[model samples]
Target: MTELNLELTKEIELLRLVTVGSVDDGKSTLIGRLLVDTKGAFEDQLLAVRKKKGETKIASAAEIDLAMLTDGLSAEREQGITIDVAYRYFATPKRKFIMADCPGHEQYTRNMVTGASTASAAIILIDARNGVMPQTKRHTHILSLLGMPHLIVAINKMDMVDHDQATFERIRQDITDYCAMQGIKDLICIPMSALNGDMVAVRGENMPWYDGPTLLETFESLPVLGQLDEQAFRFPVQLVNRPQTADLPDYRGFMGTIASGTVKVGDKVMVLPTGKSSTVKEIVMFDGNLDEAFAPQSVTITLTDEIDISRGDMLVRGDSMLEPQKEITANVCWIGDEPLEPRKKYWMKHTTNTLKAMVTDIDFKTDIHSLEHEQSDQLAMNEIGQIQLKLLKPIYADTYANNRATGSFILIDGFTNNTVGAGMII
Candidate 1:
């Protein structure tokens, strides 16, 4: 990690992308190819892959299964399907990237949602031969519903189609038309063969008719990060770092990750729920004092006037403080074996705040393939629905589409303490 200079301008760009497709659409292979072709893989792993390339019956000659990079679990290797979101990091001279390889199985949609929730771009894979399937429609609708700003439609396995221009064109049009219906206008299409490394990280001569930049080239060109809204300064306290002793005996500090915006010394801020006011006395990081701190950075803060503050509390610029609400309407993706029952109590974890909440009412269930909503009483596995939640105590939050950190949360079962649902605030 590069150190943030106190006097220099910080203009770094970070890109978060998610890859999605049905099983065997080569999602993992594509990521593997990108990493390996870009020299991101370590020497030992590359050598081991080369040695094991043609030893198995399922393995084809010159066909390196890139899934090996992320399928670290023995069961995943044996099953040959991604069950969770595996993250990998890579960088080029122009930009840095964090890629999330989301699973394609219908049963693992929750994991896919978890992976793609924070992504700025999504790569939706389509088998050239299969063209468009139900899962393709499902994921496309998901990307749109989530309001992802950008998308890449990868027509994979072009080798199976003999790299035919007509076939690629047909599939591209199919996806284009479908995405158009879902209001996804910013979409890019590319034809590539993940196994042979054609038009993935490096452009290949196999598809001369296709005249777009290779996948990696396009990734390098896409605008990486977005600026956090400077209009508001919001920070949620995560911990109170007070080690009471001589040097810092009277220290009363609130520490947490910046949920959004920026904070600096002497800024007038308001502590939520309690509605107390204070001025920023000091901004602190692990190394030393900071003149200012921005979104996503973890830091400790001291107020000019000490006021009662604790975990789950929010701090914001006086004029930007959001009103706390007891009831909320949120979009939830049901992920557990049991259906989401009405009036059932569950744990809601939003940023640093955790509260007991109950299912107040079911609004409607969305058809992932159709992007249509139908009134429903309950949400089943892999179902996306809008529902109302009544919390035991008021919690500060924002719409998921507006703020990623404050708008998202997980639903956990109290008895088992297992995450049963993933929710995005409406």
Candidate 2:
């Protein structure tokens, strides 16, 4: 195929991925090199970053630190830490990718949560010398808990180990055992030297014994659209678009991003909270009308009848959907500086619905490494536990394993507006 044809074909496949690991395990470097070697980085920009590759460069180490490419914040540059999720976009001949480079510190686990919320797959990096450490276990455990079905374990720094297949096998077995205990079954292990560009964007002769696909090759083989299509339909109204003026008078529409599934014109839909029924009259994107809309696509939807609908309302197919529930049980990861308090109400935002919720009971605390659950009264910062919650009003939700967008929620300090916890609805 011609270059233009190849580019056009690739536009049909889009992948959203996240890279995670312990501090200095080459998570960012792997992403940076992947983007750079794929010709995803601009020449002028890469040259500018390359100019500072020397001993005097205080921002990062000498030897062209690829991690610096994604570490954009001044605060991060000074401290040598990633405090928030940094996103980058790049496309290859076979696919378009949106990469989220998540933070590695235990304190910034919330950042990882934010990134993982949207990722379809995750690349968990581990240094060959370190093998499987506590933080590696923590990252992998969190990935499993968050229900990321596709996982790639890149055992980096193979060069430092003289590319020994025995060493690679040992580390791979360790990770396999760890993840197996956590109930994460789908895993791909690759021995790579991200610094040397070995088996990253291109196949290398150094690993002739390894017949598995390279990183880029693996991406090309994945069914990105299939996974995106597997989700059930969910549309949460962000804002009720209504213009009562003379121009486009009596235009009442529901504007929001489709959380999952597909919606089509003239489809029978049910409005939540009020339980009103209506048909989708039109699906409008900014440019024009659309026949259908799927997950991650933002569009305005007009209904045939003037049924009552408002912000925080949900539109769904009348059949095969869960009813709204006032009481919910969830696996909670406490991210706040203060511990979770019982009987104190916190603001919960699930999809588009915001309501007050109080913790009714604590079931158990989860140990990430051992996959053990111990009964606990409260969850402290960076702790994961199971809790029962009572919401002021019913919210339509799915089990986290079913649909991530509608099943997960965030807890905020009602008075301070600070996000305190991340929860997966069970």
Candidate 3:
């Protein structure tokens, strides 16, 4: 492997993206083409794919079955359909990419969400021949709901359409008209043929009229999302670090990943749910002690006072004064097989905290196709709806739009111990 691919530098930022759309839209193949064109695929992997293609007669003699590179599961290979999200990692000289090849089938929509929840961008594939299917809207809606910063619509199979500019325009125009009503402006559409290796990683010569940088270029150009360092400081206490030894006798450190903003040695911080205040005495890291810490960095904090704190408790800026909330109306995506009924008790786990909560009311569910609110008594699997919940314990929370890490939660069924729903505080 090249040094650029192997070496993860502090300067080289990670960009995470997820591929979503209808089945047979070539999501896996597009990812494979990217890996192959960029030398991301190993020679042994290519040989294995070539061998499989010949043995199973899955592809023509000359055509490379690029989908084989990502559809690694035996069932995925046999069925020729992606049932689970497949992740592929590849790095360019400029950036490192973690691309999730999410299943396009409607049944696997939950799995698609699981992949996309952490993505900085979502590549929603649309077959040029199909234009914009309902599945396209479903995935788009999910992306918007999850606050995905970028949406790159890959209109694939341009080769099948003879690389016609008019066909591409029509599909693009239709999508434009559809999304215009939604008032979402983060979307960018690109015409490409993942199967024929057009406009994916390489600049194919077939389409003389379609002038645009390849998909790889577009990915490299995305601005970093979530300036957490600028936001208010939030650190949920996950562990009470107290390693007692001869050298250091009385060390009491609070350990957790910072949810947002920065913290210094003398910052006045407040513990949530208890309202106890303390000054940050020191910042402890794996390497050594640090003078400062920032969002998303896991570190241990020593407070000036031995304050009452435990797991699930949060530490934040005393000046921010974020109120602990108990009753909240939030948008929820029901991901379980069982329906989410009103007044039903479920364990609501948010960040490091888990508490018994009840869905007080089922406000309305979104008709993902129509993009309209529909009356619903309960939320079914793969359904997105508005719900009011009452938590057994109040949590220091923020709106998901403000801080994704602090606002999002999951519903666990007590009996089955299954995560049944995902919620975002509005």
Model 2 poorest ten-residue lDDT run: 54-63
Rank all candidate structures by their TM-score, best first, as comma-separated numbers: 3, 2, 1
lDDT per residue (tens digit) for residues 1-426 in model 2 = 125475476465788888887557877667777767666766555655664544343232224555567778898889887778889887777778888878777464677777887787888899998898888888888888899868899989888898888888999999999899979988899999887778887667787777788887877776674454457778999998878888978898889988888889989999887888889999987799999888778999999999988888889888846687999999998988888977878999998888999999988998765768998778898789899999999999999888888899999998788999999999
Q: With candidate 2 superimposed using the best TM-score fit, by how many Å does residue 330's alpha carbon deviate from the native?
A: 0.8
The deviation in Å at residue 154 for candidate 3 is: 1.1
Candidate 1, residues 97-200, lDDT tens digits: the string is 89988877746578778878888899999989999888888888878767777899999999998999999989889988989998999899999998888998
Better of 1 and 3 by TM-score: 3
Regions more than 4 Å wrong, model 3: 1-10, 51-62, 208-211
lDDT of 3 by residue, 373-410 (tens): 99999889988899999989888899988888998999
- Candidate-wise lDDT, in order: 0.82, 0.82, 0.83
Per-model TM against the reference: 0.88, 0.90, 0.91
Q: 136, model 3: CA deviation in Å?
A: 1.2
Better of 1 and 3 by lDDT: 3
- For every model shown, the clashing-pair count is 0, 1, 0
Residue 321 C-alpha lDDT in model 2: 67
Q: lDDT (0-100) at residue 269 of candidate 2?
A: 93
TM-score of 1: 0.88
